[model samples]
Target: MLETGQVISAENGQAQVHFKRTSACERCGACGMLANGQDMIVTLENTIEARPGDQVVVQMQTQGMLQASAIAYVIPLLLLIAGAVLGKLALAPLFAGVESDVVAAISGIALCALGFLGIHLLEPRLRRQKRFQLQMVSVHRAAQGREEEQIDKE
Candidate 1:
């Protein structure tokens, strides 16, 4: 499932978010990581609404990650395979008297083009759907560590 959420705070290469999860998320790989209330750093790929201390709803799609990944990978491979089969069949008659290598070249080119098109369309959408839980919040109103500069010093 896809979720649109907000960043509550940022710290140490991570951001804490109060995200709403859908039923599909129960099967997510990341959900397993967050199962024990242990903090996990998730790579935030996209956000519809974001701000410090803002309420945001994450869009969660109900497909399990493995199934979703299979769909993403298998579809393109099928496209390439189909392209190769169709290419070979179409070129067979035209090159009936030509060398076998020449026919292979033609089919290879066709399959490559098919694969490229598949990758072009699928890769971006898959990446944009990524969302993860924040392991830690870095930003704070008051400094708790020595890194906190004294307001009076400056």
Candidate 2:
């Protein structure tokens, strides 16, 4: 995804860019509530040497976004189904007195919880990978005019 933001701070080779949540952000659900409001800030590697108050374009890989969306949404659903099936077919048999449906519900919830834990554990490693990183595409020095336009519209 591509976005425009203002560099709120800069240090070393990185900058924290503040972006107003766009229509695309509402649909993506990537940042959750952080993207629900107007103030969304992200720290990114400032390869273009953008200073504080600079308007910048940010670029993120579509492929990585899709992969992350799948990891966040799909895997847990599959695991929940798998757990429920296993509980109904395998576990219910072992517990002779228990109802199969009840066992399935319990197991499904347990596995879904485990899936969330797995994602939590995997997040740090995913963040460290370059393919998942957000990059600053360009710095715009003529941001004052655009900023004024934005304020007038608001």
Candidate 3:
């Protein structure tokens, strides 16, 4: 849904936005993130003429940042824990009663390694998807009609 929001932070062609939800977003993966509240990243085609604390109207699709970040960590952790548990309960009996703790530890370590590898593989693509700064559209003031606003940000 489209709504007006403020720029909370901006740097290096990116801005962190804060806005309220206008419509109930089901977050049906159309936005590629979960829609829970009114916080989002707006990437601009050019350097935005907005500074922090400026109110701008943002039209964005809602998505799940929390879910993505959580899935990145939690699934691997669960796999690790389960592997450790299973190693102790099921496999320990086969290897002349190998120590469950040791087996679990090894499995957990392997799972953690795999998880980290996945993160490393995805890091570059994720970075590329980060928002770029948006340019200023026309600015309107009560005293003035619609005028183009431009800023010289070095």
Candidate with top lDDT is 2
Give the whole-model CA lDDT for all candidates, comma-separated.
Answer: 0.48, 0.81, 0.54
- What's the lDDT for residue 34 in model 3? 23
Residue-by-residue lDDT tens digits, candidate 2, 37-98: 76687888888878788788888799988888788889999999999999999899998889
Per-residue CA lDDT of model 1 for 89-154, tens digit only, reads 676667778865567566766776777687667756655553322222222223335453211101
Q: Which stretches of candidate 3 lie over 4 Å from their true place?
A: 1-62, 130-154
**Model 3 agreement with the true structure over 19-125: per-residue lDDT tens digits:** 45345443422222326544444544334456676665543323444445455668788878877887778777776756778887887778777877887697667
A best-first ranking of the candidates according to their lDDT comes to 2, 3, 1
Give residue 94's lDDT in candidate 2 (0 to 100).
90
Predicted structure with the largest TM-score when compared to the true one: 2
- Which of 1 and 2 is ahead in lDDT? 2
lDDT of 3 at 108: 76
Estimate the overall C-alpha local distance difference test score of candidate 2: 0.81
lDDT of 2 at 58: 80
Off by over 4 Å in 1: 1-42, 45-64, 100-109, 129-154
lDDT of 3: 0.54
